[model samples]
Target: MYYIENVDRKLFIYTIKDVYRLEASMQEIEKMTADTDLVRISRTCIINTDHLKEIKQVKNSRLEAVLDNGEMLIVSRKYLQDIKKVFRRDLS
Candidate 1:
């Protein structure tokens, strides 16, 4: 189970396997977005890592992720810590 943002309405919804269900509060949605598969790119956007196509180095210490659905999201410096965790280091 996971949750993602609705591309059109910007609503946060829960994803059960292959189904998507709408309706959740801000605090609840924030926790769900903190999962490894989902990353918050901005105050208003959260993307699913599983759907990510590519991570591109953008200007100003930012990363741009292109998703399977043709949506591009920018990972700002504010969320850099979370970003690094998603792409964990081997350290071996």
Candidate 2:
């Protein structure tokens, strides 16, 4: 899976060429994929770190996660440290 997102209380799984609806909540998916490369970037989105390309700083102290597919996702301040820790771990 590339990324899983919760929109309007529904989960959507996005892949390279398709998107699928999942009968699950973000919390449930997180627990199930805790051991995987997936990391939550926002309240409604969890992305596969393996597919993450680069992180860039944006206006207003916010950050943006650029994916390999060229899609960008905003990284909220609340989860900034968590995402940083994940990348730090990956590098080491």
Candidate 3:
């Protein structure tokens, strides 16, 4: 599962089959899910690294994470280092 904050500022829990509303902030979810597969990829998105399918360089030094479910999410340059660390840890 993954957690994302929509444009309406509402949190949603995304699963492979469904999306349910979550009544929690992204920060709270991030902390609680820390040490797990969840990794913050941007200000509004926290993805399950286990679900990551591909990381592609999109231009301007930004990246795009394609999830197993075929969802593509942006990885802003600000969070690039952190995402790289996740990949390194996984690879190691």
Point to the candidate with the largest lDDT: 2
Clash tally for model 3 = 0
- Between prediction 1 and prediction 3, the one with superior lDDT is 3
For residues 57-82, could you state the per-residue lDDT of candidate 1 as single tens digits? 87656777677766666666577666
lDDT for model 2, on a 0 to 1 scale? 0.86
Residue-by-residue lDDT tens digits, candidate 2, 1-92: 67888889999999999999999888898899775678888999999888889888986577888999999988777877767777788788
Each prediction's number of clashing residue pairs: 0, 0, 0
As a TM-score, model 2 comes out at 0.86
Each model's lDDT comes to 0.60, 0.86, 0.80
TM-score of each: 0.57, 0.86, 0.82
Candidate 3: tens digits of C-alpha lDDT, residues 1-92: 74465547898878867888988888898889766667888889888888889888876566888988788998877877777777777777
Error of 2 at 18 (Å): 0.7
Name the TM-score of candidate 1.
0.57
Which residue window of length 10 is worst by lDDT in model 3? Answer: 1-10
Instruction: List the candidate numbers ranked by TM-score, top first.
Output: 2, 3, 1
Error of 1 at 22 (Å): 3.2
- lDDT of model 3, residue 34: 68
